[model samples]
Target: MQHLLSRSWTFFIGLATGMMLTLAGSGLASKPQDSPAFQDAARIYSILQQIREFYVDEVAYDALVDDAISAIVSHLDRHSDYLDRNEFAHLTDVTSGEYAGVGMELAITEQEVTIVNLFPGSPALEAGVVAGDRVISVDGQLLADSDAETLLMGMRGPAGSLMHLTVQREGEPELLNFALERRQIDVKSVSQRMLNDATAYLKINSFTQTTPQEVATALKELALAPQLSGLILDLRDNPGGLLDSALEVADLFLDEGVIVKTRGRYYEANVIYFANTGEKISGISIAVLINGRSASAAEIVAGALQGNRRATVFGEQSFGKGSIQSLFPVQPGEGVLKLTTAHYFTPDGLAIDGKGITPDRFVPSQVVLESLLTPIINPLPLNTVVAYQGEKKIQIANQDNQLRTALQALDHPD
Candidate 1:
């Protein structure tokens, strides 16, 4: 199945900020009208104006404003951004889950613009853009020292417009240039496939307002198989989304008991979410896949299943992120504070902060053929399955191999 993966540095940074805000809000009362903080803010504004008039180096107003905004946001939290008019509009479009652009996520690291991940079927992917590509220039304009937001702005434009990008790909000496047409790209948050007659695979890319309904529909299709065996819930690179959606998804798999608990500064923010008792899948074996990129809501699902012994997890450790943010609108089309409101924990009382879920069977990902030429049936000898690790890929001849090792274990009861 075609799957899209996303790494969410944004959520990590935002949660850190929210946690600090929660701490500050808990002990401090509303400041007086003449508070020192407000006075300091006024003084700083005046000092900036004075610098513009007296500094030896001529400074552009726009650059100064951008720098000021960046500085302020940097101090508050990672998720809270100071977006100017254009940037604000762009952020809104992206968060709203629809936009017209090249469909690639970019980040700035040490003054170099880097492509993080390109959306599947996007203009950027179609133009051969891959992760880790350094964007040297865009439309003949050098962007090596540009901020990530600025570089992204340069890449985006009206739909149907053409843009040129000069990228440096790994192991390539000559700089490659790509002329791409911008298009309206919709980021899909869900995907499903039948792994076999009885086994199905469902991957949730992200949780959105409509994710619960989408997941329900996918499950219905999987249920169409007369003798459904089990499912492989793949959350390898899912970044996460709305907390409510996470709860809803967990409820589907869990019959009863606490799904997750949240703790925050305010008593009101602390909450315990439970699953409905009589609505769980019985006698169905489930296996979940995770990696360093699986985070937030993905962690919630993994934690729930692991706690209840409902699924056998496989893959590397997950991305350790367990903080929750609550968005508070501050102004009309101006800005908002995405404050950290709470910390979440699995029902088994495991802290997920900086501590990821350890898979029961650690299996490193391997690049297998798109379609297995010869499908192995059940009750095959254990040594026949292949085990791929490191640079050396080896094949086995009988039932004693690793794949058979897992299959044999699954065949026998715990």
Candidate 2:
């Protein structure tokens, strides 16, 4: 999948031409040589050329240039990345909240590709793929030591194409192979259902550009249910997307409260986002589900709900990623830089850097539900209740256990 820059000089030249055209179209004259802006651009170009020609190893010039562009932006902060034309288009598709794929979220772990999450009703999920399963190979090619990005790219293809994957699951004697056909994955950001004909269950996968609208639609549907008792907002294994989307989603449930705030080196980056008037589900008990994989914008929503006591967070601690990245168009066509512009905080002013949103109840990954059941003679004909005694009270029986637990908790809130 690696393309050599020298071999693609035509592409590079075209990219450079496009950048020049964009600059010209802007109608802004080049700054004088004495200007700091001009000098900085010149210096960056010089470094890029030097590394391209004189780097000790045979580096991919295109990748080197992209990395150089990214390095410069990194000094600004963490959210930014250098994206070429293809990368930019792919990014756009993700934010658009729809694309064609097998419908699984993947991550690199210990140099092996792992299934981080599976979209409900996705082909992958229907094929019996589950989180924590290590992908051993793709299309019969060994994927050991391969980067997650590369592995994912290889697995993705046009609709109607097929991808073969070999996976290694924990405590399994044989490797599992699955043949998945590519299809358009319309990412459903929001899904709602009544947990027990009273409590509503809403699961938000990520906060994409359309997330706010999707959440609103789901909320409106759930609100139609009569005598709603409670709500379960599941953010488990959700990696954040759009910040604004997260803010809007929080606003749907919160009434007149600070959702989240951002703080950075610059004063301008320090600002607070507040929930406006109007509560979609006011005066309803709420419980939020989060895990170590819940990060970024997910943390924002969970933190806001927890801080305002709007919801009681349950499950393991969340992934501590509080930094906000702002995309800056550095050199259009050549690449764009994503920079970490700010650090976000909860409504109660709790920092979320290394400290993720701690759940009100800590549920561990072991201890089966069988241990929670108590023998009852003539058990009362009432809804059963189970609470996590400690970290080891719950067990990871399967990939669906987390969701099952969340549903159970919402049904019988202690």
Find the number of clashing residue pairs for candidate 1.
9
Q: How far does residue 400 in candidate 1 sit from its true spot (Å)?
A: 20
Kindly list the per-residue Cα lDDT of model 1 for residues 124-150, writing each as its tens digit: 898788877888888888775565546
Give the TM-scores of the predictions, in the order they appear.
0.73, 0.78
Off by over 4 Å in 2: 1-32, 35-44, 47-64, 70-80, 109-112, 369-414
Prediction 2 global C-alpha lDDT: 0.67
**How many Å off is the CA of 115 in candidate 2?**
1.2
Compute the lDDT for candidate 1. 0.64
Top model number, lDDT:
2
TM-score (C-alpha, index-matched) for candidate 1: 0.73
lDDT of 2 by residue, 1-414 (tens): 000000000010001000100011222357999999899888988987887788888778777776666666557522344566665555556666677778876644345656766777777899998888887888887876564444555665688888887899996999999988878877777887776677788988776668799889988898888888788898886767667778789999898889998887866668888899998888788888888877777888899988988888888998777876554554556544444557788988988877888998887633334454444322112334454656646322323445556666666777
Model 1 lDDT-worst window of ten? 11-20
